[model samples]
Target: MASVADNLTMALRKQIGAKLNVLLLRFFDQNKSGEILSRVTNDLDKITETLQTGLLKLLVAIGTIVGSLAVMFYYDVLLTIIFLVFMAICIIITRMLAGKNLKYAAFRQETLGTLTGIVEEYYTGRNVIKAYNHEKESMEQVCANTELNRKATQKADFLTNSVNPLIRLITRLSQAVIAVIAGTSMLKGTMSVGVVQAFFQYVNQTAEPLTQASYMINTIQSALASAERTFELLDSEEEIADTKTPVVLNRAKGTISFEHVSFGYDSSKLLMKDISFTVKPGQKIAVVGSTGAGKTTLINLLMRFYEVNSGKILVDGISSVDMTRQGLRQNFGMVLQDTWLFGGTIAENIAYGKPDATREEIVAAAKAAKVDYFIRTMPQGYDTMLDNEGGNLSVGQRQLLTIARVFLCNPPILILDEATSSVDTRTEKEINKAMQELMNGRTSFVIAHRLSTIRDADIILFMENGNIIEQGNHQELLIGNCETGLQA
Candidate 1:
């Protein structure tokens, strides 16, 4: 017959394999999971071992008690009752602790997860602290969270640690009481020598597992808590839904429309209300406003990152709902406000998510975005390692590299979010010339605060508090005191 260990391992593997989203998260989880897996295996293995050991001792205790009872029952009834009462007390003590201890163990495991999240946050941003010389403050933050975790663990362990000595003390005291009662009965010639000897042996066997069990509960509780937290994360709502049959968008002409769209992170407070707009194919639209004017929200809606509260967004009169998120995003290229570069080669970063682009295409995209010049001058050229989120490159260079990524993607609809903010005026003009060429026969949306770039846009929108308050060609918004000089 297969061992219990083999059966448990097989069951665990099957459960883990069944939940795809949970399984994916586990693959990404590099911390604690390995230890947790080992712990479950150990705890379960010991349960089998503990049963074998505990059962044998229990059987021996029963035999001794029976042998003593046969003779002792013939002694005074009071002596038999006295010994039985103390044994009952030990049983009650063990029963009370078993369930309560398990709960504390779960709470301690949750505290550990919070600590891990904080540690992972710091490790992910270590270079940010180093580059800006924020190491002291970052170190202090980590220390504070660590101390908090230490206290939480100590508090949870307090109950577990106390139960063992408390249970053991009660068992010892009860055994002493039983011994006295049996000795007194013997002196009265009410019990035989064999009976007293068997009574002592029975007491040891009965009290041993109870005392051992109190300590065992502590370990079992901790394991239970870990399982609860892991399961909680796994059960959380996934980011996107999988369709039984997904819609396939074969081609895009870049026509986008928003019909009375509204959204908010919280439903009670609406961010954008009934905002409607239409972009014809190949139109260059500039969304201009001060900070917090909901320009980014508009881009988010276009990308389908967050669902609109009401109304509809359509591409070529096709409802965004009909398109899979992947299909919707594949046709639109975006450069975010927060410039992100992966840790890899200059060439590899450019070809991200578009693995089949040719070497000549990658070089051409980099040249168009003006990143090729810097990459060529580097010690290893396009093959240089860019650890630390490409911190070795300047902010402008990183932004250009991101632009090169978009150029390689070459979507029908392009979003440039403060795209020219990083590069110098000279470099801006060069990128602008290239961008103008690239914008041919494609719809584009530019989010900008700088006045210079908007002058060349075919249409301008001045949004305030999510409404299009002012709209025109560049000259129209400029005449309304947003410009430096006289009105048109």
Candidate 2:
């Protein structure tokens, strides 16, 4: 019975953990990954540990205490009453400790989460810290978090450990009292030797279970603390659900338009206000701006990574909000400044956008991205396995792989966000040639840090302070700027 109950508890814990894992991606997208990892791993482990042993011990203790008490009464009613009074006192003492155990357990779990966050951050950014010669500062931060975790764990463990010894002391005292009562009754000729022996045995049995029961109280409090943290994450608000009867974007010609758009990460301050733009099918549009000029914010809105405060972003002629998110995103291909390559074969990375792509299809895309020659130089060619962080590949090589992924996808609309910025001048020229070929007949949006790259664009939107201050072909914007030495 204990084993079955324990298995059920474990299964329940796993199911809840799995649900929390999925919800974390959608609900806590802005939250740190380390905090989520701590809740799923450390917090869930505490609940499992208690359920596996503490629960079974608790149940056995209850049964033993009742059975022992009944046998004692059958042997001698007066002796049983004497033990009961002492047992009641022990119960009161254990009750007084409940709140403190809870407080410490919760504090310990919280500190563990903070410690995990520090360790994760330090490890992920170790290279950056060393590059900036801030290794000493990073180590100091790690030590600070470690010290806090140590103190909290010590307090929680001390409280839990203190319970067992106190319970044992009370049990010994109760047994001593019971022994005297049994001795007196046996000498008075009212009790036989056998009954006295049995009575003594029952007293010990009762005390042992009561001691275990007291310790179980502490186990339960600790488990509840961890469970509460897990539940808090599970209950966090999820992303906005798709509208009822959402429009499915079956196919689109890629004409894009943004009408009177307004948005801000914080509601009190507007970042992009009343923004409007249009790009006809097959047109090449370039958006150039200084840092913090809301250039990326515009792209995020187009991809629906964020919703606009007040505006309509249309793909084809349909409002983005009307379409299901998945259906809407299917029409676009994106290559961002940060190239993401997972631990897999080079071929797999290129086929990420089309998982079932044929080998020939993958090879063709690589060639178009101007990376085939490089891949051939590798000993394993397409089969070469990438390191977890792509440590084996150069920055330009990683970007080329990402571009190949988009080529195989072949969506009607394309977004290149500083796509060639990470490469050297030579590689940038080759990548730009490949990109131009890919963007030939697609409605494309280019967010460029290099003005030279977008000089030939059909339209250039030069923005400042979240508004387009100038919009025209490159020559038109440059006509007066050359004379004044100031941007139009």
Candidate 3:
């Protein structure tokens, strides 16, 4: 269990992150995050606190109405009942309008999330859009999403705003009816001047709370929509689960096995089923599959990004669950399909995996990854800064930097996902040599589309759908499936 302070910090972060993420993720927010934050935090907090405010207002109104009615009835029952009847009609009208306002608020929030998701995806894939020359079309899609969000917000505001006007109009009409009846009653000597004056005060007091209550009702409804989203995010499951007494693994022998492991993002939709494999220390394993054939998903499962639907995974004779996520991941280094490099020095980036590494060790790791040679030739050498998507370095150089990071970590298990997929042939050759060096004396799992990189792999597994369709060494699979027209 997290400490109260930790939990509070997380809640605050989520609230802040939701807003920052909305802002940072410019494409996803049609209504913007700041406004959303105000709605969820400020507005919702007001709503929750208003229960007391509403009750107090109602109590005061009730007392005033009761006292005034008592006086009116003392003078004449028929006239007092008329005032009560008019008030009843006003209450019914405002209640219906308040309900409509609430419904609109809920609908607006759903529209906001949808708009946010659209913007996020578009901005993240802007390069792809440019490559395809679909920038104009993409803008059209965003505009359409923005328009929908605007209309939804407008609808909510319009309905909420309608409440006050309707309340005022109904209250005024009820007062007019009361005045006409009371005046006539008093003229007939059935009502006193004091009674009429008190009744007027009571009628306004009744209608005031009724009107304010309607506003509070609408406020609570709008706030609920925002609160629900904020709460849902806070209540969401964390990506990593660590036990109190987590098994620590500073170093591992790197023996891993998938024991009849069947897993999926969704239970009913299995990504890999009945799959069994073993990776011994210092062995090279290749996983080959077409897009969506469970290749990356396999890697994801190994990293424990998603839990297996059934069966189990073991590393060093211990169940994966027996170790902390941090513990399991500490023994391995990974380079994802998407290259990730923070804005930092080349040496800093290389030394990230092993923060306390000596300069000599950092240089050695960089040399092994074929990154040191290039860094030394640069104006700042290892201290060169990579900024704005590593604009200073080519894609190949960025890859080498990632490899340097992996080398510095020197984990017993290495997982590379499409590491060489985007590089040119020349860079690929250099990286392949570095990869071979890194793979020595360690267990490695490599996912690559290029057949040549994995040609010498000890074992190759080809997958289709969620199952391994073929399994063997490259030489054997090639000779056997040569006529079947399989592409690496």
What number of clashing residue pairs does each candidate have, in the order they appear?
1, 0, 3
Q: Candidate 2, residue 227: CA error in Å?
A: 1.8
Best by lDDT: 2
lDDT of residue 131 for candidate 2: 99
lDDT of 3 at 215: 64
1-488 per-residue lDDT for model 2 (tens digits):
45764575577577766666445233555666788788878987788778777888998999999999999999989989988888888788777776788888899899888888778888888889999999999889889988988998898888788888898898898888878877887899888999989889889888888989988988788888988898887677544666788887776788999999998776678888888888889989898888777777888889888778898999988999998888888888999988899999999999998999999999999999989999999989999999876779988889989999999999999999888888888878878888889999998899876666568688787777887777777888788456422243
lDDT for residue 1 in candidate 2, whole number 0-100: 48
Cα misplacement distance, residue 427 of candidate 3 (Å)? 2.9
RMSD of 3: 6.2
| Cα-based lDDT for every prediction | 0.72, 0.84, 0.74
Clashing residue pairs in candidate 3 (N, C-alpha, C atoms within 3 angstroms): 27-119, 28-116, 28-119
**Tens digit of per-residue lDDT, candidate 3, span 1-488:** 12433454456656656544323222222344444544455434433454434445545655665676677677667766776776677678667766776677667776766666567677768889999999999899879878987998898888877777787788888889889878888899987898788777767766776666666666567656655665654454444345778777778898888888998666688778889888788888888877888888888778776778888888887778789877998888998767778888878888888889888999998888777888999988888888866767877788878888998898999999988766788878888887898899898988886767668788787878978888778888888898534544
Rate residue 270 of model 1 by lDDT: 88
Candidate 2 matches the true fold with a TM-score of 0.88
- TM-scores of the models, in the given order? 0.75, 0.88, 0.77
Name the best candidate (by TM-score).
2
Ranking by lDDT: 2, 3, 1
**Superposed model 1: Cα runs more than 4 Å off:** 1-145, 180-203, 237-243, 475-488
Tell me each candidate's RMSD, in Å, in order: 6.8, 3.3, 6.2
Q: Candidate 3's C-alpha lDDT? A: 0.74
